[model samples]
Target: MDNQVEKKKKTNPFLTYFKDLGTAIAKGDVSVKLSMLFMGAGYTFHKQVIKGILVTLIEIAFIIMCIFYAAPNLAKFGTLGTVQFEQVLDPLTLQTTVNDYDNSFTILLNSIIALFLIVCFILFWISNMKSVYRLQVLDNEPESLTKKHINTFREDVRSLFSEKFHLTLLSLPALGVILMNIIPIFVLIAIAFTNYDQAHMPPNALFTWVGVSNFKSLFANSLTVTFGYAFRKILGWTLLWAVLATLTTFIFGILLAMLINSKTTKLPKMWRTLFIVAIAVPQFVTLLLVRYFFGDTGIVNSICSNIGVTEFLKSVGLVSQHLNYIPFLSSEHWAKFMIVMINIWVGVPYQMLIATGVLMNIPSDQIESAKIDGATNFQAFIHITMPYILFIQGPSLITDFVKNINNFNVIYLLTNNAFITPDQKLANSNAKEVDLLVTWLFRLTNDYYNYKMASVIGIIVFVICAVFTILSFTRMISGDREGDYQ
Candidate 1:
C-alpha cells in the first residue's frame, strides 16, 4: 500500500490534472454541464437565486469587457500597431490635414490590461465550474433546499467573518498590490524587452518589441562598449563601497556603543548626543554642508591656506604648486574616498543606537566567566560579545549592505555640483567615476531620457541585490548556528 501511494505520488502532474478534470466532467449532472457553458445555470437550476444572479452578472461583465477592450487590444498587441501619423492636403478645403497615428503606448498598456483580465477570467471560470460540480455532488446527498441555498449563504457569510476573516481583511490590500506593485513590475520587465528609448518614444515614434536586444546591446556593440565599461567600473565600486561602508560603520558603531556603555567613560551622554546630532539633522542638509566644506574654495581649503598647509604640501611636492586649491570633491579618487568617509560618519549613529540596545541583551554571565578565566577585555569581546552581536545582527547587516548598494542620495547630493572634467566621464555613457548603478540609472532616465538602458540597468541592479539578499538569508537560516554560543 505504501509502495502504491509512492507510485501515485510520482505520477506526472499533467496526467493527474487531466484525469481529475475528465472525472469531474463525466460525473457532473446536466446542470453542471450547463453551468460550464453559461456560468450560472447550475446555481439557477438549484434555486440559488442570489448566487445565480451574481454569477450571471459576472459572466455578462466579462463578455462586455472582451468585446470592448480585450479583443481589439489583443489583436494590436501582435504588431503594436503599424499606422504612422501623416500630413496630407485636404481635398475638400485644400488645406493641410494631420491624420492620427497608432499610439504604441496605448496599445501596449491596453494589451497588458487585457492579458491581466484574461488571466482573472480564466481563474473565475475554473472556480465557477468547480463550484457547479461541488453543488451537484451536494445535491445528490439529499440536503434540504433551505440548507443548500439560504443556509449555505449564511454559513459562507459566517465563515468569512470567522474562520476566513484574514482573507476578508487582506482582500483590499491584495487588490492594491496587484494593481500597483505587480502591474508596474510587469510593465518594467516588458519595457526592458522593447526599444522604448528616446528615439522610439511614443505617439510621434512607435517602438516595437526587440526581445533581448536591449540586454545584448549593453555588452555587444561599439556604441555600448563605453556603457559596458562604465557598468563594470560602477559595479566594482558599488560592491566595494557596500562592503567597506557596512563594515566601517558597523565596527565603529559597536566601538562607540561600547565606549558609552563603559563604566570608565566620562560624560557618555554628551558624546552620544554629539554623534546622534548627525542623525537629527536632515541628511540632505548635512550632505550639502559636507560637500561645500570639502569643495576647492570651501572652509577646509580656506583653513589649509590660512594655516599654510597648502604651501607646505606644495613644498613637499604632495600637491602641485600651480594648483592652489585641493580638489577634494573634484578629483575622482578623492571624491570616492570622501563620499565613503562621509557615509561612515552619517550612517554610524543609527548603527550605534542599534548596537547600544543589542549590547544590553548580551549575557553578563558569559562575559563574567571569561573574565574569571583570566580572559582580558579583548578576549571576552572576541569570544562572547562578537558572536552574540553577529548572531543577532546578521540579517540586519545584510539589509544595511543592500541599502548602501542603492544609496543614491549620498552619492548624488554630495557630488551633483562637483566638477568632473569631461575627460574623466565615460566615453558615451552618462556616468561619472563616482556614480553607482542606481545613480547611473537616475542619470539615464532623468538626464538623457535613455529609458531602455535605464530599464536594463534597473533590472541588473535588482537581480544583483536579490541574489545577495537570498544567499545571505539562506546562509543565516540554513546554517542554524545562531544559538551555538548559548
Candidate 2:
C-alpha cells in the first residue's frame, strides 16, 4: 500500500508543474509551457496584440485628457479658489469659473480610460484563466502524468535542496521592500507630473498631469514668487546645514567619546549612561519640551530676564520697544541657530554611544605602544586611535549626515509655525524659515495641500539622498584618498 502511494505521489502533475515554475523563476523567464500555450493559439496571440494596442491607446488618451480637459478645469478651480464669488460682475464670466460644474469632456475621457483599462485588465485575467484550464487538463491526462513511472524522480529532487524553506526565507524581506518601500516611492514619483496643487486636492477634486512645469517653476520661473530666490536660499541653507550639522556633531561626538574613554576620566559607565538618557527618551518629546522652554513666555526668557541679558539687550536697543519678550524660537536666524544647537544636544548622545562601541573595538595595544613612545594623549589619539575608528564607522557617520539633512521632527517641533511668513514675497508659498526640504514638502502636502509641488520636492529629496548614499558607499569602500585621516 505504501509503495503504491509513493508511486501515485511521484506521478502528481500538480507537483511537477510547481517544479517547472521554480526553474522558470530562477532563470528570470516566464514558463515555456505557458508561453507555448499562448503562442499555439492564434486567437490568444490576436487578443494579446489587441491588449497591447489598447494599453498604448489608453495611455495616450490619459495624457490627452490631462492636457486638454483636466488642466483647463483645474486652472479654473485655482482661479475660483483665489477670487471671491461677489467680486466678479459678469454672470457669464462667473459661470465659466471653477465654481461651475466640472467639464463634461474631462469626465467622459476619464470614464472612457477607466473602462478601457478595466476591459484590457479583464482580457489579461481571461488569458490567465485559459492557461490555468490548460494546465489542469494536462494534469488529468494519463500520458501527461502517469500513475506508476515517476517515483524515482521525486526522490532524486528531494535529496538536492529544501526548495520550500529556501524560497520562503529569501522572499520575506524582498516582499517587504517591494510592498512597503518601492511601491510608495514609485507612486510619489508619478505624482510629480500631475497638477495636484492646493486647489485640486484629491478625492474632492481631481488632479491631472502638468508635464515639467512644476520642476521649471521650482527651479527657474515661478509666477507666485521670484523664481530662484526661495529655491537657492533653501538649497544653500540645506547644504550648509548638512555640512555644519554633520561636522559639528561628528567632531564633538568623537571628541566626547574619546574623552570619556580617556585614562584620566573616572566612572565611564555612569557618564555614558547619562548621555544615553538623552537618546533613551523619544526625540519628539525632548524637542517639544525644548521648544516650550524657549517660547515667548518660557523659562529660558524668564531666566534671561533675571540674568539682565534682556535688560542689556533693551539698553543696547538690539530688541525693538514693541518686542517685550525675546523671540528665540520666533526669529528666523536665531531659530536656525537654536535648532542646530538643540540638534547637537539631541544628536551627540547617539554618536557618542556609537563612537564608544567603536572605540572599544580599537586595540588597546596600539594606544599602549604609542604611549610608551612618549606620545601625548592627543598624539596617541591622532596617530593610533582615530583612523581605525573612522574606517569602521565612516559609513555610519555618513548616514548620520543624511539623517540630519532630513531631520524633520527636531527642526519642525522646535521651530513650529514660527518659520512661516504670511508675506507672499517671502517664499515658495507657505514655506517656513527653519523647514528642511522634508518638512517643507510635508507642509506642502499636509497643510497647504499642494501635492504636485510636494511630489516634486519629494523627488528632489530622493535625488539628494541617493547622491549622498552613493558618495558614502564610494568613500566607505575606497577610503578618504586625501590622506587626511591616515
Candidate 3:
C-alpha cells in the first residue's frame, strides 16, 4: 500500500492531463478532434454559430496576444535590453532618433505580465478543450442531435445577474488584484535576481540578471559592508520590540480597563474620556509632539535638568558626562527604551478600549464562582477574566503580535533623524540603531536607492511576517481550546 501511495505521488498531474486530452481526441468525432486546432469546430458543427464565433474570436485574440504582446517582450526577457537608451543618427531615416532600447524594468515587468497572460490562457485552453469534448458527447445523444442546446444568450446574461452574480461582483476585484497586487509582487521577485541598483539604473543604463548575487551580499559579511551584522542587530530588536509592544499594551490595557471598571475608582467615566481623548487625537501628531518634547534642547530636557534627573542619569552612566542634557532619543539603549514607552503610551489606549468591550462580557457566572471559592480579585482575574478574554480575543492577540513585527510608524517616527547609529557595521549597511525591517526597507529604497538589497530585505520581512502570522493563526485555529475558556 505504501508502494502504491508512492507511485500515486510520483504520478505527474501534467502528464495525466495530456494523456486524457490525447485519449479524448483519439476517441472523438471529427468535430471534437478538429476542436483541438480550431476552438469553434465542435460548436459550429453542432449549429451553435454565435457561440462558435465567440470561441473563434477568443482563439484569434490569444494568437494576437502571443504574436504581438508575449513574443516581443519575452524575446528580450533574457537580456532585459541590449541597447542603451539614447538618441543617435538613424541610418535609414537619416535623422537623429531614439535607439530601440529595451528598458530593463519595463521588459522585466511586461515579460512577467505576458507570462501571466499565457498561463491564464493555457488554463482556459484546457477547459475549452474539455468543454468541446463534452459537446461531442452531448452531440452523440439523440435529444441533442437536431442542434446544440447550450444556454441562450439571454439565459447566460440573466444567469450572470441572478445565479452567477458572485462572478459579476468579484470580476473587477480579481482584475485589480492581478494588476495591482499580484503582478507587482512578481516584478519585485524578478528584480531580486537582477542588478537593479542606483549604479545600474534604467533609462541611462541597463541591468541584467546577476543570479542570487544580491541574496549572497545580503547574507555574507565584509569589512566595508556588514549586512549580516546589521541584519542580526535589527532582527533582534525587531523581535524584542514586537514582543514587548504587543504584550505591554495587551497586559497593561486589561489592567487599566479593570481599574476603570472598579467600584472603588472615582470619576471612572471622566478618566475613560481622557484616555479616549488621547486616542482621538491623531497618532502621527502625538508622535511628532513626543519627538519634539524629547529632543536634546526641548522643554522636557530642560525640566529633567531643573529637576536634577539628568545628574541622576549621569551618576548611573545613562547620560554622557560631557553632555548636560539627557540623550533620550540620541543614545541607543535610551532611544529604544523611550520608543517602547511611547509605543505603550500610544497603543495602550486603543488596547484599553478593546479590552473594555471584552471585559464587559467576562461571563459573570465564572467571576461569581471564583469569588464564592474564596478567590481574591487578583486570583479571580488571573483564573477567570484573563482566560475568558484570551478565549474571545485570541485571534486578535495573534494579529497584534504580527502587526507589531511590521509596526513602521512608532519606530520610524520616533527614531528617524532622532537616533543615529554609533556602530560602524550598521552604518556600513545603511542602517541605524533603531531601524525596524520595514523602516530599513524604506530607507534602502527611498533614501539610498539600493533597491536590489531592499528587495531582498523586503522578501525577508515578508517571509518573517508570513511565518509568524501563519504559525500564530494555525495554532489559534488548530483545536477546541475556545470551548475550555469562553
Candidate 4:
C-alpha cells in the first residue's frame, strides 16, 4: 500500500486537472469571450461590477430629476400669468421659484438630448462591466480547480498598448478624421431633420425638428416644384465639365511636356521655367485676371475687334458685329465653355510639371531601343514613354480628376455670383446655371442662410467624395507597384 501511494502521488489527480485547465485557458478564443463580455452573460471584473452599480444609480437619479424637478416646472412655465414673472422651482411640489422662460423648447430639447446621452452611457457602461466580469472570472479560475490554466487579462492589455509605433501613429490621423470630418458631417446631417431654413434662423429664430417633411417635399413627385430638372441639369454639367477638364488637361499637358523635353526643342529650361511661372502664381489672381479678360469691356473682345474675325465675318455677311459683344461671363453656355477652357489653361501647367518629372524618369534605353527598331517618335512615346508615365502617375491622375470635381476657386472667381441667381424655389437655391454642387452649397449657406438645405447638399457632396476616396485608397493600397517595375 505504501509503494502504491508513492507511485500514485507522482500521477496526482490535482496535477492532471491543472494541466487540462492550463491547456483550455491557453487555447481560449478572445472573440468568443469578448462577445460574452458585452452581453452581460458572465462576470469578469470587480471594478466593472462596481461601476455598473454606480451607473444604475445615476439612471435612477436622471429619472427622478425628469419626473419631480423638470416636468412640473416646465408645465408651469408653459402657462401664462400665475406669478409668471417669478421663476418656478419644483412647481409640482410648490417648493420654490426660479425663471419665466424655463419651459422653452430649447431647454426641453436639451433635456431630451442629455437624457438620450445618459441612456447611451448607461448601456455602454453595463456592456463594459459584463466584459470585465467575464475576463476577471477567466483570470481567477485556477488550473487545479477547473482543469484549465487561466490566461492573465493584464498580459493582453499590455501587449495591445505595446504594439508597434507605426501602427499606433495611425490613431492620430484616425482621431483627426473623426473630429474634423465625422463630427461636422454628422452635425450637418442632423440639421437636415430640422426646420433650420432661412426663416427659422438659430439663436433668434429657433428651428425645431421637422422630421422627413423636408425630404418628402423636395423629392416626392406630388410636390409642385419638381427640383428634378435643376438637379439633372447641374449634375449633367458637373459630369461633362469633369470629363472635359481631366481629358483636355491630361492630353495637352503631356503633349507640351514631351514637346519641351524633346532633343529638337530649343532652350528647354527656359520654356519649362515659363510654364512653371504659371503654376507658381496664385490661382485666384490668375482666374480673376482671366475673368476681367472675358468681361464685356475686356481685352479679348477688344483684340478680336482689332483682328479680322469680327469684321471679316461681318464682311462675308456671315453674322452681325453685335455677336462680338456677347456676354462671355453672363451667358450660361458661354460661361460653362469659358470656365472649362480657362480651367485647361490654369490646370495644364501643374500637370505639365508632373508630366515632365515622370517623363525625365523614363529609361532612355527603352526609348533608344524603340528608335533602333525604326519606331517613330509617336510610336516610341505610345509604347515606352506613355505607359511608363501613366504607370507612375496613375494615382496623381485620379487625384487630379477629384480636384476637377470640386474646383471651385477658378469657377467662382471667374464668374463670381453673376451666373447663380437666388431661386429659393430650387433644391439648391438658384445654384448657378453652371455651378457645381459645392459652389451651390456654399451659396445656400452664405447667401440664402438656408442651413438645412445646405447641410443636405453637404451630405451629398460628402457621399461623392467618400466614394471616390474609397476607390482611390483601394486602388493605391492594392494595385501594382510602379516603383517596383522601375
Candidate 5:
C-alpha cells in the first residue's frame, strides 16, 4: 500500500484527476445516470429537494431561452436576413404603405446576445453535471461521515462567508470582467465575420455572414486593393512609430534623469520641476496647444514669418519660395517626423521621473568598482547602467511599445485638420497617409459608417499588439539574462 501511494505521487496530476473521475463514474448508480439526462435527478435521490428543484428550474429556463431567443437567431446567423423594405400601394385606400423589412442590425445584436446566453447555459450544464457527480460520490461514503459532511443550502451560504470568502469577494469583479470585457471582445470578433457595413444598413437592406470574406477583401480583392496598400503603409508606420517613440523617450529620459542626479548640477529640484510642469498639464491640452502653435497662421509660424525665417529657408533651397507656410502638418514626411518629436516632448518627463526613481536604487558598489578599475564614464554606463536599466525596464518597455501603437491622440490631434488632403486619400477607403490602424478604425466607423471594415481593422490591431507583446515577453523570459546583473 505504501509503495502504491509513493508510485501514485509520481503520476501526472491531470491523469490522476481523470482517473479519480472515472472511478467516481464507475461507482455511480442509476440516480447519477439519470441526472446526466435529467439535470437534478441525483440531487432528488439524495433528498436535497430544494437544490434539485433549483437545478431543474435552471434547465427549464435554458430550454425556454433556447426556444425563444437562441434558436431563431442562430438559424438566421448564417444569412442575417433576406427581406428589404419596399413601398407598396394599398389598392383599396390608394395610399402607399411601407412593407416589413428584416433588420440586419437587430439580427446581429440578438444573435450575439443569444450566443452569449448559450455559452452561459453550456457552462451551467457542466456545473450541474459536476454537482451531481460530487453528490453521488458523497452518498457512496460511510453513512455517519456523509451525514456529518453533507451541506444543505443554508450550510453552503454559511460556507461562502466563512471558508469561501475569497470566492465571495472575487465573484462580482469576475462577473463584471466577463460582461464588460470578454463579451464585447467576442462581439467584435463576430462582427468581423459578417457584412454589416453602410451598404447593408439595417431596416433598408440586409447583411449576412460572409465567413472570411472581410479578411479576403482586406488581403486579396482588387476592388479593395487600395485598402491593402493602406493597411501595409499604416501597419509599417505604426510599428516604426512605436519603436522610435519607445526607444527615443527611454534613452533621452534616462540621460536627462542622470544629468539632474549628478552632484555638479545645481538646483536639481528646479530643473526637475520645469520638466514636471509639462507632465502636469493635461496631455490633450498640450497636444492641442502644440498643434495650434505649429499651424500655418499660428504663433510659431507667425513669429517665423515676422523674423523672415520662412524666407531664409526658401532662399537656402530648403522649401519652395512659392509656399509661404512651412507645411509642418500638411506634408506627410514632415508630419510624421514632427509627431515623433512632439511625442518625445510629451512622453519624456514621465519617463525621466520613472528613470530617476530606478536610478536611485542602483547599488553604489558596482559604479565604485568600475571607477576604481579606471573605466571611462561611457564604458561604465554601457557595461553597468545600461544593462541594469534594461533589465529592470524590459517589461515596461514592451508595454510602452504597445501603448505607442495605439497612441491615437498624438497622431490624430496634431494632424487632425491638416493630414487628410485630397491627393493622399485612398481610392475607396477612409485611410490617409498619417493614419495608424487605430485612427483608421476610428475614421472607418465614425466617418465612413463602415462598421464591418472597422471591426476587421480592430481585430488586426489587437492581433498585432497581442503578437508583439507575447513575442517580447517570450524573448525576455527565454533569454533570462537579467540574473547576470545579480
Candidate 6:
C-alpha cells in the first residue's frame, strides 16, 4: 500500500495524457490517421454520413473564419499594427479624407481571440482522432462488424438525450463561459504586458508590448507616478477594510440576532421587521441618500452647526477650524470610518438573518451544559455561540471577506464627487487614500484611461484574493472539527 501510494504521487498526469496520445496515433487504423489531416474523415470511413457532414462543416467554417476574421489581425499582432492614422485632401471635394488606420487594441484583441479558438480547435481535433480510432478498432471485431451492432447517427443523437444528457445541457453554458469569462480574462492579462494607456489611444495612436515594464513600474517609485507607494498604501487599507467589514458585520449580526432572540427583549418581531426594511430598499439608493446626509453642507452638518456640535468638534480639532462643516466623507480617517459604519448599517441585516438561522440550529445541549456548569450568559455565548457560528459560517466568512475586498459600489458612490485625496503621492498615482484595490482599478480604467496600470492592479487583486481563499479553505477542511461539533 505504501509503495503504491509512493508510485501514484510520483506519476505526472499530464505526461500520462501525452503517452496515451502517442499510443492512439501509432496504433490507430488508417481512418484514424486520415482524421489527423481531415476532421470527421474517420467518421466517414465508419459510414456515419450525417455526423461526418456536420463535423466537416464545422472544420470548413473554422477555415473561413481564420481567413476572414483572424489572419489579418494575427499578421500584425507582433508589432500591434504599423500603419499610422492620417488624413488627406480630396482635390475635387476639398474635404479631409481620413486614411485607413490599423487600430492597435483591435489587433491585440483579435489575435488573442484567434489564438484561443485555434487551441479549442486543436483539442477538438485530438478528441475526434481518439473517437475515430475507437470506431475503427470496433470495425474489425466480429460482433461490431455486423450491421445490427453498428452505431448509427440516430442512435448517437438518442444517446445525447439519454446517457449523455449532461453534455447537451452543458454545451451552451460552456460556450458562454469561453466567450464572456475566459476570453476577457486573457485580454486583461495581455493588456498588463502592454502600454495601453491614454497616450496610446487606438486609431489616433499606437500601444505596443512593453514586456514586464508595467509590472516593474508598479513595484518601483517614480517622480511623476508614485505607483509603488500608492499600491502599498491602497493594498494595506484594502486588506484592513475587508477584515474589519466582514468581522464587524458578522459579529454584530450575531449579537443583534442574540439580542432580538433573547427572552428579556420586548417586541422582537417588530425589531426584526424594522431591520428587514433596510434590506428591502435598494442599496445604491440608501448609499446615495447617506452620501448626502454626510456631505460637507448636508443635513448632518446643518444639525451639528445649529446645535453648536460643529463648534465643539472644531474646538477639539476634529474638524478644521478654518472650515464651517466637518469633513465626514472627504477626510481620509473620517471617510474610512463613515464608509465602514454605513456599510454595517447596510450589510448587517442580511448577515443577521443568516446568523439567526445558524444560531437556532446550534446544539441546545451544549448551551444548557455550559449554564449548568455555572458559566454566565456572556461566557457561554462566547465559548459556545461564537465557535458554533464560526464553524457553520466559516465558508461564508471567507466569501464575505473576498466580497468586501472587491466591494466597489460602496467606496465609489460614497466618495464619487465628495472625497479628494489630500496626499500628493496617491493623487499622482490616480488613487485616493481610502481607495480599495478594486475602486483604484476602476478609477485608473474609467476616469484616467490608464489600462496598463489598471490591469496590473487587477492581477494583484486576483492573486491576493485567490491566495487567501485557497489558504483559508485548506485550513478549514483539514481540521478534525466533526468530533468537537458532534
Candidate of highest lDDT: 6
Root-mean-square deviation of each candidate, in angstroms?
4.2, 12.1, 4.6, 11.3, 4.0, 3.4
What is the lDDT of every predicted structure here?
A: 0.84, 0.67, 0.87, 0.66, 0.83, 0.89
**Where does model 2 exceed 4 Å of error?**
1-34, 38-161, 221-223, 313-322, 422-424, 474-486
Per-candidate TM equals 0.88, 0.67, 0.89, 0.67, 0.88, 0.93
Candidate 3 ranges with C-alpha deviation above 4 Å: 1-27, 87-97, 144-149, 265-270, 475-486
What TM-score does candidate 5 reach? 0.88
Per-residue alpha-carbon lDDT of candidate 4 for residues 1-486, written as tens digits (9 for 90 to 100): 999987887779777545544443444345324433333222223323444445446656766877775566445433311332354488589787555433233443444445444566655544444444445566556666655443344544455567645556687898787668755665677677776777765333445567776665445333455445556566677767777998889989999998898889999999989988986889888888888887866888688778755577567654344676545777677687788888888888878888998888889998898899999988997888888988887776767777777878977788774554444445434566777877777777888887776776667667776777777777788876779967
lDDT by residue for model 5 (1-486), tens? 998987877777667656655654576688877776777888889867678888888888889989998887777777887778788898999999987777777777788888887888776765666667788777677778336576887887788999999999999999999789987888788889888888887787887788898887777536535677677878899889999999999999999999999999999999999999988998899998999988877788888889999999879976667889777777777788888899999999999999999999998799989999998889989999999999889888998999999999998889887676554336367777888889889989888888888899999989888987996788677877777979
Give the C-alpha miss distance for residue 246 in model 3, angstroms: 0.8
- Candidate 6 residues lying further than 4 Å off, grouped into runs, are 1-12, 144-148, 472-486
Q: Which of the predicted structures, 5 or 6, would earn the higher lDDT when compared with the native? A: 6
Instruction: For model 6, give the 10-residue run with minimal summed lDDT.
Output: 141-150
Candidate 1 wrongly placed segments (more than 4 Å): 1-23, 86-98, 143-155, 221-225, 266-273, 312-322, 419-421, 424-427, 475-486
lDDT of 3 by residue, 1-486 (tens): 999977875787787778767777787788878887888888788756677779889989989989998899899999998989898897898999777777888889889999999998887777777777776777676774476566655776789999999999999999999999899888888888999988988888899999998888887789976998888889899899999999999999998998999989899889999999997988888898899999999899999999999999999987879999998899898899999999999998888999999988778898898799899988988888888898888888878988998898898888888888888889988999799888998999999888888888888887888887897778676865767866
Model 4, residue 191: distance off in Å is 2.4
Off by over 4 Å in 4: 1-175, 211-213, 216-226, 311-324, 417-428, 480-486
What is the C-alpha lDDT profile of model 1 across 32-126, one tens digit per residue? 78777788888877656667778989999999999999898788887887887677998999999777678887888888988998999987887
Score residue 309 of candidate 4 by CA lDDT.
58
Rank by lDDT, descending?
6, 3, 1, 5, 2, 4
| lDDT digits (tens) for residues 286-324 of candidate 6 | 889999999999999999999999999999999877989
